[model samples]
Target: MSYPNPNPYGPPPGQQPGYGYPQQQPPSPYGAYPGGGMMPGAPAPYPTVMPGGVKAARVMLFVLAGLNLIGLIFAVMGLGSVSKASKNASEYTTSDAMTAMNVGKGLLIAVIVVIVLFIGAAIMLGAQFGNGGSGVRVGTIIFGVANTLVSLLSFPFGLVHTVLGILIIVFVSKDDGTAWFNRPRY
Candidate 1:
């Protein structure tokens, strides 16, 4: 008669370790820390490093902010010129000239406001790239789209903005971008 098996939890004699039972999963190659490996039905962990595409998008955002800063300076200068022209036009008492000056001043003010807002948004979103979540991703995408549309109005001069915006959109919308933004904070 066969002797009783010493290890009752192990496979039967003459059989492989998993032969008459469910197989055990191998240990994780990444070690036993959290996010080291995915469980059987669990979602995969986010990458530890930021993806290239996301980095590119972040750079684009900063570039856009810089460009807007330049535009803001020019717009302010233009507003000053318009104010000076309004003062000169007032001496002549020409309603037409004054009307034109007022319109120019209004438009310039509007441009300055828009540029400031865009610059603020671009800088804020760019700074958030390192630790921001999906909301940041969505905000960046929206910023890119808006920049692209605005660039279209400026044509050749805005070519740089157009290209940067498109690149930002593409880079931030990729799978790696999604993963970066969705990564666990802790």
Candidate 2:
């Protein structure tokens, strides 16, 4: 049986609201909206994880550069000490002076070569963080792996550097880091 309408202002009995009645909320764990309550109409989220590794990679490069400098200072000091000792010993032997001087010069040259190679590498890696392309990522990975292996030869002297280099390698290869390198820059 159909029921007659009692009031004229409100909607008829058993009929849907045409204009004034508020909408009913759906059942959910979180009152109305779920998934952290995002608004009904909002723009898609932007990429955020891509820019984080950049600063970390740059800082690691700077740290490695400082280590290279410290190594250079130590190498120079040791070279000086060896040369001084050799000079004192050579005074006792008549023909040993020239030979000793030659050895000292050779040792100094070797140290200088190693220092130049490593310091140059450090500078290159450090400078790349500014506006580096994808090649920089590959370069950094190569450097980090090579550095870790080379550092092992130095043992205690390069322990810290090895650890830091490994971290650099890991960071550069991660998802976010890869994304950062692959990003399109206009």
What is the TM-score of candidate 2?
Answer: 0.63
On TM-score, the candidate that comes out on top is 1
lDDT of 2 by residue, 73-182 (tens): 87788788877766677446666666776787787769677767867876787686656668888988988888788789888988988898898898888866776676
| TM-scores vs. true structure, each candidate | 0.77, 0.63
Q: Quick one: RMSD of model 2?
A: 10.5
lDDT of 2 at 17: 76
State candidate 1's TM-score. 0.77
What ranges in model 2 sit over 4 Å off?
1-50, 94-108
Q: Residues 44-89, candidate 1, lDDT per residue (tens digit)?
A: 5677788889988998899889988998899999999989877766
Instruction: Report the error of model 1 at residue 67, Å.
Output: 0.9
Candidate 2 clashing pairs, residues 3+ apart or interchain:
none
